[model samples]
Target: MLAVGAAALVLPLAAGAAPTAFAAPVSAPVLRAPAGGYEELMVPSKMGPVKVQVQWARHGGTAALYLLDGLRARDDRNAWSFETNALEQFANDNVTLVMPVGGQSSWYADWTSASNTNGQKTTYKWETFLTEELPAFLEGYGVSRTNNAALGLSMSGPAALRLAALHRDQFKHASSLSGPLNWNAPGMREAIRVMMLDAGRFNVDSMAAPWSPAWLRMDPMVFAPELRGLPMYISAASGLPGQHDRPAGLGGAYNTANAMGIEVISMVSTRAFQSRLNTLGINAVYDFPSNGTHSWKYWEDQLWKARPHILNALGA
Candidate 1:
């Protein structure tokens, strides 16, 4: 029974193996201006000031995408920031890139009673932040806010949908790659436990007691009814390779083991969460990449693939 922290901290995602004995920092060329656009912004967050930096190729068009991060992904660098170069890939695609920063493990939810607002307990209000705050603030850049899409990796997968589901009028499309679709599942509790414990923030006694509802309240499945009518793109690396060094020998029996062991990310109890999305009558561009795992390689490919479909949904 670890004591949950009074000050919740989000552990960042894996970035190019830290200055290590084997791998060096990913060296990619800078996203040049004139052909690409870049900006480092300080946006307001429920926790504190957030710094968002983005670079994208400049092409003429109305396509836009918003990206969020996972718990282990930090503001400093994540798979995309340190390993994969985003601006280099989409610079000439005529798509506008919008990134709102500082949500490592925050789940991009609007806190109802966790954050501080007007000397009162408040919700993180992430919904308002992305849908209303950031868009309104970035409107000065001559970018259209009409039918933008949201893309996220890991924990942010659901966040992307939560945004679109809650504010469908604002986002024309939603896409999640390598994200945990079922948070309420029994299999999820262990991962969540490991995550909270590793971060020195765990309290089983408080599970679903008080503030816990806020977390589940933000899960997309809870809002599935609203999410069903939207155009979505979902992908996972099913029957895929595992993470870096995880093996089939390490008792790959537990949910976490299978998740980190093989590259295939799935639910043991309900393996077809992706297919279930189809059953809901929402048209989706779904891909179960062969031998894929939870890594930047999968994310980069998934985002690149989902680009056109999303843009078209936005009427770009």
Candidate 2:
């Protein structure tokens, strides 16, 4: 077993530099058990060394599925492992599960400028890290370089779509569950600013300068044409409390209300993207449930529903 309390080392690189090959693991990764089997890897990046949790396929296939986290991603573990049964659900599948830890409010994008907070200067180069660095590192461990799919929820929904659209050669399929697809849609820019603040006290201006072209480039709705031929899945809820919601008493009521609002925003934005795809004559699998909220239960169900499609795209 690897030692607990492993020290993290930061090796910063020049801004906007290409991803360098990762050196040998700074320390051996801590391995977990079967149902949630995963290896915690500290991957070197342009920003800093980021933690990536990976669950190898039980069937030992080379195909990979990169699962991105939401705005409130924890530094310690991917919420998919902590909050859902994704590891067990994909245990027998012939695809590696890649989950990068931490990103709270980063939006998984390469920011225009760095932000200084609490005496630390941080630059979010997530797009480069995920697409170039992480995959290069994973190649040594038997994960495929080209046969991959990307999935994300909430904040990462658009990120996943944008990555697939921008790097069509790297990803074969993409799925967004309860993600805000249209970033520049009316009222969405402000909503994103507020959500980023609530998630990590992050400044939206720092992430993308006022009216930066990055916003237009990152908006999946704007780049839907780029995703025309790729297999894709998009899902969202109606924001209504449904069978999956089990709010307990007053706190539960508040949680339900919050989920309702977020899911409603997701529904509206996702529908707009869907409309754009239709206008482009691009076919994509879509799941718009009538009675649900923005919560993990629905995301988990969407993952299961989209799995076959993902695997099919991967030719697994």
Local distance difference test, each candidate: 0.58, 0.77
lDDT accuracy of residue 216 in candidate 2: 78
List all candidate RMSDs to the true structure. 7.3, 9.3
lDDT of 1 at 280: 76
What is the C-alpha lDDT profile of model 1 across 1-316, one tens digit per residue? 1111101112322341333232232222232222356666666555555555555436545446787766555445434655556656666666667666444335676654542212323334667778776666555454456768888876688788888887877888898887767666544555555554443243322333332665666655666678776888887776445443254554433433334432343322123555566577756677775555455666777777887787678765
The runs of at least 3 residues in candidate 1 whose Cα sits more than 4 Å from the true structure, single-residue gaps closed, are 1-13, 16-35, 60-62, 112-124, 199-216, 242-259, 262-271
Model 2: per-residue Cα lDDT over 236-258, one tens digit each: 99988999888789967866777
- Using TM-score as the measure, the top candidate is 2
Scored by lDDT, the top model is: 2
lDDT of 2: 0.77
Off by over 4 Å in 2: 1-37, 116-120
In order of listing, the candidates' clash counts read 21, 0
